[model samples]
Target: MNCQPWLKTLVYKCINIEHSCLLCSELAEQHYPLCVACEHELPWLDEHCLRCALPLPMAGLICAQCSRRPPAFDQVIAPWHYGFPLDTLISRFKHNGQWPLGRLMAEMLGLQLHHRYLDDLARPDLLLPVPLARRRLRERGFNQAGMLGRWLSKALAIECDEQLLLRTRETPAQQSLNAQARQRNLRRAFALASAASLKGSHVAVVDDVLTTGATAQAVAQLLREAGARRVDVYCLARTAKPGQA
Candidate 1:
């Protein structure tokens, strides 16, 4: 009997329901398991490229890479820079199977998206989680993006389609790859579901983090070619450029 699957299920089902900060173990003042002071200390995104959400020095400015060659996605929405506790939280949720942490982040991200909608940020017609390769999914026992999309769907009342995209082929991990290599590795890696119909529809790709934006770009390009009017990437954090972090 393989206990790994059962353990995974247990991890997903069990959550820290107490209103205590996941970070410092203090009583959470608000609904989230995070206190106001700890939340304020998160590495919030200050300035970034309008297209890829790459951290920048100033607002209302596009990064050099985007200016030279715009990506397929229209824009990226992220709440924080991938640093310190943010990175640690994401790592635990992703690799260590601590799903409650991911859930908390997704909830806050949903709130941020709701506020953005109120400020003229267009609401997407559908939320599409980036599909995990079959092998990786089997190894991890869960897809972080899919979970995030499910939570966001409920919070925002937007439909989430887990079957909208499929990972066509398994590829090497993108963590060690540079931008060009990452893009090359993702080529022909994703395919739209045969029954998907996105003609003129606005869609958002949900993921845990946007590092090189290569995966998001590939997914967005595929959706755009499939008749999606606009494709945006929604993620929890964005990493600094290579060698900058």
Candidate 2:
């Protein structure tokens, strides 16, 4: 007879006593789920915009576009670029419900953030996940950003408050819109709960990816309006603007 479901699960667990790097399948001997080689070779971010973390030719400098009209968030800390295998992994995790991939991504992000925090970066007083509207939440069954935030909050010992930010109205997906359209779509879409106040606080808004920075900008504006002293966008990956190199 075939093995029972529980027996199969037990066998799977027995086989996975040693964790392997998700990318190269090498045995991961250390913490955070990836082997040293694979971790180093992953699509790490570098030479990005100081403000939005958009991939660029130079590091520690803001881009010309941002110089003209700066975004509301003060800083962005992202470890990876949205490309290749990393993109595939994130898509599987976010859309296909492959939770293990998400956990691995979250752990990697936490490791980067920990390093930055130790190196004198200003750590946010709170971690707030970019909220999903009710309709999208229903369709997806879970918010990827919220899950990422939970992992990061625990790793850094920071307070995470996902309930404070509310998505008041559902709008078209940001990916389908141009920069102007995206801004217009998100206008007045986010609000703070009555009991929540960002007065004199610094917050990091957590998300899975920062593409055009539209969503982050919108949320940061809301936080600033509510009296938050500063806002940072914390994401796992930061994509180059639609046509930029």
Q: Quick one: best lDDT, which candidate? A: 1
Give me candidate 1's TM-score against the actual structure.
Answer: 0.92
Clashes of each: 0, 0
Per-residue error at 117 for model 1, in Å? Answer: 0.3
Q: Residue 145 deviation, candidate 2, in Å?
A: 0.7
Q: Write the per-residue lDDT of candidate 2 for residues 1-245, one digit (tens) a residue.
A: 67699898999777666788777788887665678887777788989888888899877888987899998999999999998778899999989999889999998788888898889789889999999989999999999999999988998999999899999999999888888998899998999999987799999999999988889999999899999999999888998877764
Candidate 1 local lDDT, 85-203, one digit each (tens): 99999999999999999999999999999999999899999999999999999999999999999999999999999998999999999998898899999999999989989999999
Off by over 4 Å in 2: 1-17
lDDT of 1: 0.94
Best by TM-score: 1
lDDT for residue 90 in candidate 1, whole number 0-100 = 98
Q: Would you list the C-alpha lDDT of every candidate in the order shown?
A: 0.94, 0.89
